[model samples]
Target: MLQIFSVTFPFFALVLCGYLAARRRMLPLEAIPGLNGFVLFFALPCMLYRFGASTPIAQLLDYSVFLVWMFCGLVMVGFTIAVTLNDRIRWNDASFGALVAAFPNTGFMGVPLLVALLGPLAAAPIIVGMLVDMVITTSLCIALSRLDGADKHGMAVALKNALRGMLTNPMPWAILLGGLASYVQLELPGPVHKTVGLLADAASPVALFTIGAVLARSQILTVESKHAPIPLRDYVPVAVFKLLLHPLLVLLVGVGAVQLGVPLSRFALTVMVLAAALPSASNVSLLAERFGADNGRIARIILVSTAVAFLSFSGAVGLMT
Candidate 1:
């Protein structure tokens, strides 16, 4: 239908543009890392700040819905393993697996898609979800990964790292400052707002273009053909958990919360689930490489789960809309 195309085409168009640019060598592979940094630290934070500041704090701070959804994701891990053919992975791999399953591509894909299909009011819930994602889910992943590797630093270190990461994160700061400003009824200065708006506007298209460049750099086709054989079985459980189980868990939590008199919009519920259903962040590979985790396996997990999430996400949309 034209409605669906109106919603879906822009996303794919960005992807297509990025892919074509890479194929044409208009953007070098090496520029992607720096471009990603700009998107993540500068553009993304500016966008989140604006989004959070613009949203009503009461709606964004819905503890009931947030907790229920978070709990459901926490519990679903074991259930996923029981239902699927999973391996006995070490902590690093398990940490990566759980996060890939739980943390969707909310920043790059979910926000833009929601803006198109759902509209402006929907941005509030998307921003709230993004806040939770940056502050909680990511920190948890990093802590658990370190724990998985037998780091004896205890909870203190984990908490410290998490907070430090949050403090260092420009987007979280934006959200905080914006929320405070909103609470105090301060209006954004016109010229400052305009400058941020321009930079934030570039976030989605440029980020997606960078993702395309990264994917092209991976040379998936060649790897698929020439690498030592990968056990397709290894990926099956990760895909199942990330693509199918996680979204369902979020939906179940949403329905339960709604039934229990939690004040959440159906639209908010939809955004939360879509956020859960997005593929793993592209940075998973980058982090794995830097940390000496199993980067190869992690890359495969990212690729397979992302490839499958398209269908999974379409299903979520059908249920929600």
Candidate 2:
């Protein structure tokens, strides 16, 4: 209990501090992009590079864990799509809604928090989960979203765009470079290593704070907007799936995988479960807005699930510990 809090408290406390600062306008909203830029472009990549550089390539290439995580994500996406379709939601909106339900905040929140709780080695599973989300889950959602409209893009094009998006994302590149260094046994010069180490050290705290600040900004926007109040029914299902069902499905799938002789480590299993329990990815709302889906509903889902994740995530970590 206290032990678990000791481990998990600082992570959420940083988030709380950031949220309060932003909510009170203590931190200027304009500064957020710079802060995010530092994390995404520099600090986080360095941290992940360090992890990948040091870890064995075989451990990083564990397909069993990837498969299990992807299976659970696909299941959630399918279930959400079916439920939304039953409600007569447009296919595009339904696909995005399903995505909101399935995709966890693995990059910003999960990576730092998991590494904090489970150590740098935990990055392996986190990265695997991110790949699953980026490649399989997101591609499928995008394909389904394209199905309803006059976009006329074939599944091949949709998948290609998704792959291109994944390649453009710096995280994967950092991971790949790190893995290459590790595989080749190339040593970074002392000065460069030290610089990367410095940036890597900054990744966790800054990233966590950025998440809190973003959440606060979202809350502020929701309050000031003139849009009609979204029905609880509209976002609640997505919230439930994001916070509860997704993790549950992952856990079940992981257990079954272990029974079938998958070599998932205890730490990796714990990391996967915790990652699944994270809030919905903030970008899902952005994607919804871009694709002309129900962005408002998706935004509300992100806000509510994130607001509730503190307790849910704490409970998850505590239980696993």
Candidate 3:
């Protein structure tokens, strides 16, 4: 566990640099979107392409565990709706609430931490999990946010919109293309591989820094002083769902996998649990803004849950590892 700590600490430190830089105005909030674009569209995709393509297909197939994790996410979504169904917070806010409750910071936080602790083998499961997340969790949040408006589109339109969003997402596309390339045995030449590697190396540092910048610029805390109720109560259930229930569910699944003879290593299991315990994606707040939901509360949840997740992740490592 202590050895794991040695590896994990540097990742958190990068997050801290981003947080502190933004908090101190060393990087303006306005720069975050562009930074995000670069990470999402370029760095992450390149990294995914390079790594995902190289991983063996048979190793990537963790059908039982994947099903379990997806089930956990679905259960959390249902749980969120039940908890947030009140006049105090509308249904639209509930959708964002569900998203906050269910979506882990699997991209920025999950990938780097996994790579650091578990080595290259962790790439396959993380990529698989990410595909599940983007296709399901993200789509639901967007569709639900639209429910609060008068523009009631049909189910087909909502489905189409969600599919489009997923299809066009550069990060997912990169992973998909990389997987195809790997499957087809399309190896890149040495110089191109080196170039992609260089860009990929920049991903973790840049992403963490951008998260800090986004958090710094977030308006969540400021809404507290306003006359509106600010959805304080809504945060309670969502945070509990994320920081406490989510990890427990993952742990249970891991234990079951162990019992059923799943071939995951200690390191791989550790990555899965840690990824599960991470806070809601920092992107959720931006997503809330895009869909006309409660952005401020979403931001606060991201910040608070991130702080909680550090402890949660460390504790999980101590107990499981």
Candidate 4:
């Protein structure tokens, strides 16, 4: 466990560094979005593209891994909603809360961190999981968020909006282009490849830092005196679901797949489990804010899960390794 902590501490420490930087005005609050934009648009897409282009097409499109992870995500969305829904908590809150529980921080944190711990092969499962969350889990949750809304189209409108968001996102397109490049045995010009390589290399540190800064910005924005003090019930349950339940479901389902002769590699299974074990994606709060959900509660859940993940995620890695 101590050894595992040695591996994990720097990652979490970077997160803390971002938090403190934004909190202290070292990185101005206004600049957080720009930093996040650079990461989302340029750094992360290039990183994913490189991974997708380099990985074998078969593994890149590993349907079994996709199905197992997707099933677990589906279960998480329903289970979390079942437990957390109430008079005070409606569809939007529960649905987004469910999203946090199911969608790990794979892009920003999981890919690089898990690869460091597990090696290069870990990228495939992590990337597949990232795609699953971004393409399907997130879209479904967003649609669900509007199922009870007064908008005449309700879920249909939300679904269209989700598809629009997915289309506009560069990450998936990068993955697609990379896959096509891999399929055609295409390579970029030396200078262009080097440029993408540089951006890919920048993805890890900048992304992790951006996550912390985003968290700090969320914390700062939600600290208004007018808002009611948060209770444990509002955020802790969802945090527990994200940090514990999500990964556990992945592990159990993965093992079942193996026992059923699904040919899922143990290493891939481990990667998927750890990927699921990742803290809630930091960006979910932004979605909550955009969709008019309770951003404070969402941010609190992210902060709690992330803080605890350092210990919980490291311990899981120690045991699994």
lDDT of 3 by residue, 127-158 (tens): 77787788877887677666656236644566
Residue pairs with backbone overlap in model 4: none
lDDT (CA) for every model shown?
0.68, 0.82, 0.76, 0.90
Q: Write the per-residue lDDT of candidate 4 for residues 1-321, one digit (tens) a residue.
A: 787888889999989999999999999999999999999999999999998888888888898899999999999999999998898889998999999999999999998899889888888888888889999999999988987683466777778888998999999899888888888888999999999999999999899899999998988888843667878998999999998999889999999999998989999998988888889999899888878788889999999999999989998898778
Q: Tens-digit lDDT track for model 1 on 193-252?
A: 898899889888887776666655554433644756557765567777777777778888
The true-versus-predicted C-alpha distance at residue 51 of model 1, in Å, is: 1.3
Best by TM-score: 4
Rank ordering of all candidates by TM-score, starting from the highest: 4, 2, 3, 1
**Cα lDDT for residue 296, model 2?**
71
Best by lDDT: 4
Residues 1-321, model 2: lDDT tens digits: 677677777877887888898988899988876887898899989988898898888877889888888888889988998877745477877888889788898877788788778887888888878877877888889888877662566567766777787777788888889889989988899999999999998988898888788767766666677656777877888899889998888888888888889887777888888998998887676567666676677777887888788788889888876
Please give me the total number of clashing residue pairs in predicted model 4.
Answer: 0
What global local distance difference test value does model 4 have?
0.90
Better of 1 and 2 by lDDT: 2
Task: Provide the global lDDT of candidate 1 against the true structure.
Answer: 0.68
Q: Candidate 4: give its CA RMSD in angstroms.
A: 1.2
Q: Candidate 1 clashing pairs?
A: none
